[model samples]
Target: MTSLPESPRPAPTRAAGAFEVRLSDSPLPEPDRRALIASPRFGTVFTDHMARCTWTAGGGWSDRRIEKYGPLNLNPAAAVLHYGQEIFEGLKAYRHADGSVWTFRPEANAARFARSAHRLALPQLSAEDFLGSIEALVRVDAAWVPSGEETSLYLRPFMYASEDFLGVRATQQAEYLVIASPVGPYFAGGVKPVSIWVAQDYHRSGAGGTGAAKCGGNYAASLLPQQEAQSKGCDQVCFLDASTNSLLEELGGMNVFIVGADGSVATPELSGTILEGVTRSSILRLLADSGHDVQERPIALAELRAGLADGSVTEVFACGTAAVITPIGRLAGADFDLAVADGAAGRVTTGLREALTDIQYGRAADPHGWMHRLL
Candidate 1:
């Protein structure tokens, strides 16, 4: 018997130009805003406005607008308050040397946001709306986009269950918002290698869980282990698979990669427990384009240990939205400690970081068309 053909994907809904603009009346003065942008913390300083929209089971998405940035009012019994039904996406808007603003692969972030909403029982927002919201906020607060070296406006788009019921069922109402913050380098010391603590006691995700989704609960669960890593004098924490605890999973907030001396690069495969990061995929593409043997497969902890001991694993690094790429300097556990090749940033790691950042800040050509112009 012949099998039926797969269904065609639905066309993305277009909601651009739907957000109504309501500029803030008491915006910060130019000098103050400039001072804040000069040396801004990662997520602390915010722009003057934010974009918002509401979703309902009956009415669907409505009331899209750009409003003043401030605290949100939620019911005490909101589903997200107790059930943790929420999702978020992070990306950046860069100011090119020619004074144009752009973002890197926002469509990828929008697709992932939809997948996360499906996983968390929240409403799936359209790609047009997602991009529209970001553009709306950035257009009103264009000055917030920093022009310094390695500085950009960090955009955070998030959705949450706004329904007041607490019956543990899917939310009937939801709210989506986009906020912007000017940020400098993710790491304060500027691209230095970092130490990691291998988490022997805690696991990030299991066989069937929300590990693949970008939600608040997953991050909430990692706080204790991260604190433990800090106590051990490490900058980050590495988690192993939950089933056997022998395979490498990921770091606390980023994906990990191992580079071999033989010009092979490998990272943990997407096993339904690892968050598919946009930066991670970009680096993988860069690696493949440069003719490196890129492998996405199960990386056994024992194998990594053996490779490091024998000098087969020449470099290690982590990638995420916040920290674009960070070299793994040392790996420490309860029983063992291993430094990655004299504890300095490796050649491959630095090269990939600069290559990717070049494409981001428009220093080099974007051959893959990953950069999206926002303004």
Candidate 2:
């Protein structure tokens, strides 16, 4: 019953059901959506419509629709709340300079979402259907996309087990939904340097854990360390590899990068433990395109501190969908601390940030064809 045409690729032998778009008659008025867009805050407000698809073992996927946004009447024994079989993704829709709305590298997110679904034992949605769902939502809520500096509409697509029975395993029924929210500037005034606390006591995930997947439980595991960082007046938390306890891994929500004094940039390699962030991958491409030597390898904590102390490391930044790029000014640990480039944002950091945003907003030429126009 899906109105969106299917791709010519062969369907999976055990594919989930496709969804249908049910246009909302009571959609938000233009004036109201515009008013909300004028000063839209991040993740505070939602659009008028949301895309949903349900899955079951016997019937496969069915009852797909873009229904009105509201609370769901869930049973007390829903599997998601009890068993935590859920996964989600975060991406943005940028309103281009010419008033066109587009998303950056959504195919990456779709593929990651499918991987997360498989890891969680949930039904996997096809890449075509995933892209179509995002397109449908963005098209319906195009009015909610703001056109201010550093402003965008953040899209969150999530899937949760919805079976009423809870047996501590993967449920047969699952629900997938996509929601949009117009967001303001991530930084209030300007992009300032952030301090990161080393999470020495707690490890976010192990080697074989679901660390690479963008699942809810991984984030839930970091809340305590995040709070600890907040209490120490730091902005974010950085974790080391659980086994070695020395090599760099990633931050709570973003991937970390360091610029060496040798005019080279280095990021932690995606070793099945770090989240493969879209922004991180984009930065790698942008930096390489700009003729900067980029390396994805294992960097040790001692090396980072030594580089910072000797002025060999020029800049350090974190990248993700939400924060985009945040320069890490200082690294704090139990016994020592080091500041990169006098705790100031470096030239390379700002340049890469601008380049990525340029391609995102369509102000510069997208040589890589990373943007997909939705409206």
Candidate 3:
């Protein structure tokens, strides 16, 4: 990477923070860019520019700039490679019908990113800085935001130790970056009911672990269980609490919810052992606002299975950033298999999915002031 100009260049200013966005000398041709966005795959390609900033004890978060997307020449001894001291967040930019750009609940992602940074012993970047990076990056590559149905520009903002130290302590230097990718629908065939494998041999997070943080290690720990789930003819893995293995914690990558026949919605309460999903929180609020009795409490595995068996729990679904709402049709383990009514997406599940996506894709009113426009 080249050094910032001796004198700062003209920059865009945000209410909270501002940064200079330097255009790339060699940008992708418009034709190729259009063709790629026509049918893009997840995480397979990147935009022309990236937003970045570095932090140090003496210098603070200086040299804020949006530079060309390229490889990093990190030293072999970087602490992150060996010690894994990093945090990251995922959100998306959408193209509305009138050619404006927006994102859903970005402030929540910024808040969670700050919480993850604190948990990882990384520097605390203000919410303004976080939102600035996303807005700035999207503003630079505004064309990459796709306009097709269920298409978006995925934004991944991550920070890691830049210090080339082998010590096991938090490094004094770190680098924050935001990159973008054009992605089509997560499920090309449309949202369908999926089967889940109950993880009998593994736990996603332990007591007092990095469960609530959006760190890489937490996902690394889930890979094995996810692989096992895939091998067991299931679309995902349902993780139980590590201590008791009875109380439901979460799925491998999504928060879970169950709807009963009595117009009640219940999900596993936050116990510091599951991800605080933005989609999960929004769905809960939307359900409660629609006059449903929403409960956040410890949901036991036995309770879920018995409800399914008795036809009381009519619907089950998972939520995350990628696939907003995924219906769970069957729960399979070594000795038991429980299926929801008709093994199809239930009314409550479909209603919640529509309610959330309608707002996300600009089809419904955002009464909660969650959508933040970028362009």
Candidate 4:
């Protein structure tokens, strides 16, 4: 696994903008807004406000603001549209049962966001600054936070090159913005096993590519394969290492994990070509805490199939910020089909899911201090 270096402690907190709060006049209707917040779907409905900060090579970062959520009048020649210089992060603010809102390991997400920015050649935001931006916005939209089961205010922090140039290079001018959506469950129904299409023709990232970064291009490249998976009646697609095409890499939007018949857990190690999902890392820690001998190493495709055949692999699941944990029922390729046991959530899989959700919903003890109260 890829171990993160010692994280530098952030300085004292400060007001995000430090200047006068420039409020937006364009706000949503109160009653309609309440209905939307009551059952907001994933990424479909958004909060009324957003946080944005501008960056320039010469002027550094501008004072940020909680602006009205609206369309961006981007230049037709924006570099993000041409050069594809963009990166983003996905996290959530949960309303605990005690009526206080909190988030899990937001610092980890903030750190990963910086790493992703560095990889994309974009300016990095300080951990404190990043957290402050989100917190500031969440505080403003505190009433928009949903209290339904498995519901959260999904925060999407994105940076994109806003320079109005068509040159095929990273731009010096960029804009970072955080938009929030009150989202319900990722899957429409309750948690269920999903079939995955094993993609062999197209790869999400190759050797020495920008795979680790949660950039827009990587997801754009997977659209075709993802559509193909949908056509095949699969819920998602799994990608293997681009070089060897044998070792399991990750799914389209989540990381994969396998449980052994002997009750051990295993997941593909970070090979610099797969996203380091926050949910995936947390699950590893949770599994170990539950006394499962977790292994993070290269898991060969052939070995997984063989293990499944011999009943050694008990369960398979995929995890990410969107879907906390989704069990895999089968893997469909062009020729052969690999089916997991009965297309059901395994004992270990469901147990970990419940445990993580418990912490998220404020039902379980947070021994690791992962929950940071926002309200």
Top candidate on TM-score is 1
**Candidate 1 — which residues are off by over 4 angstroms?**
1-14
lDDT score, candidate 1: 0.90
Q: lDDT by residue for model 1 over 1-375, one digit each (tens)?
A: 122342332222245468898989999999999999998889999999999999999999999999999999998999999999999999999888777778999999999999999999888998989988987778788889998888999999999999999797999999999999999989889788999999989998888999999999888878899999999999999999999998999998999999998989999999999999999999999999999999999999989888888999989999998999999999888987888983476889999999999999988999999998776
Estimate, for each residue in 116-199, the C-alpha lDDT of model 3 and write its tens digit: 999999998888898898888888898899888778999999999999889889889999999999997665666788899999
Task: List TM-scores for all candidates, in order.
Answer: 0.95, 0.92, 0.94, 0.94
Give the alpha carbon lDDT tens digit for every residue of 204-224 in model 2: 889889998999888998899
Which sequence of candidate numbers ranks them by TM-score, best first?
1, 3, 4, 2
Residue 228 of model 3 has an lDDT of: 91
- lDDT at residue 294 of model 3 (Cα atoms): 98
lDDT of each: 0.90, 0.85, 0.87, 0.86
lDDT of 3 at 108: 95
- How well is each residue in 160-221 modelled by candidate 4, as lDDT tens digits? 99999987777889999999999988988768888999888889998789999999899988
Clashes of 1: 0
**Which of the two candidates, 1 or 3, achieves a greater lDDT against the reference?**
1
RMSD of each: 7.9, 5.5, 5.7, 5.6
Cα displacement (Å) at residue 15, model 4:
4.2
